[model samples]
Target: MEKDKWDKKITYPDLYLQFGSEERSFFKEEAKHLKAKYDELGSFCELKKFTGGHDYIKWNEEFVKTISKLLKT
Candidate 1:
C-alpha cells in the first residue's frame, strides 16, 4: 500500500468513498480557513465556523445517514 498525501496517510482515493466532491471541498475550505485563522491568531485551537455550527454538525450526521443508507442498499 502507498501513503497518502495528507496526514493520517489513509489509502489514496479512499476518502472519496466517504465523501462527494462538494462535501470534500467544503471540508478542504474549512480546514484552509482554520489554518489561516490559526496563523494570524498564533494558535490553531479556535475552529472558526465557516457555516453555522449546529447546521454543520447536523449535516454531518445526515451524511452519516447517507452512508448508512448506501451500505444498506
Candidate 2:
C-alpha cells in the first residue's frame, strides 16, 4: 500500500469506494472509516454500498461502475 507515502504532501486524487452490504461488518466499518478520513482530507470520495458479498462478482460490477464514472469525468 502507498499509505506510507500519503503524508508526503502529495496531491491526492478523487476516489470511489464500493462495498457490499453482505460483506463482513469489519470490512464495511473499515471502509466507512477510510471514506470519512479521505473526506476530511478534502478528497472527493464516494462510498457505495450494494447488496452483494465480498466476491469477484460484486468486484466486477463495482469495476464497471468505476469505469463509467471515470469516463464521465
Candidate 3:
C-alpha cells in the first residue's frame, strides 16, 4: 500500500535551526526540544550554534553562508 504524505513512515523536507550560543537559557532549551522532535520524525535537520549572542552581526554571516549553500548558484 502506498503511504500518505502525512504518514509517519514518510520523511519530510530539510530543516535548519540556527541559534546563538549565548542566547537565553530558556530559548536554547526550546530550540533543543524542537530539534529533537524533528529528529525523531526522521527529518534532515541541522542545528548550528555560533559563539555569539542574539546579535544581528553574527547571525548575518551564518545566514549568508546557509543561503549560499542552499542556492548553490
TM-score of 2: 0.76
Between candidates 1 and 2, which one is better according to TM-score? 2
What is candidate 3's local distance difference test score?
0.79
In order of listing, the candidates' clash counts read: 0, 0, 0
Give the runs in model 1 whose Cα sits over 4 Å from its true position.
Answer: 1-23, 44-73
Give the winner by lDDT: 1 or 2: 2
TM-score to true structure, per model: 0.29, 0.76, 0.76
Maximum-lDDT candidate: 3
**How displaced is residue 59 in candidate 2, in Å?**
1.7
27 Cα displacement, candidate 1 (Å): 0.3
Higher-lDDT candidate of 1 and 3? 3
Residues 1-73, model 1: lDDT tens digits = 1231333333222121122234456665655554554454455332323333335565676567766866998
The lowest-lDDT stretch of 10 consecutive residues in candidate 1 is 11-20
In terms of TM-score, which candidate is stronger, 1 or 3? Answer: 3
Alpha-carbon runs more than 4 Å astray in model 2: 1-10
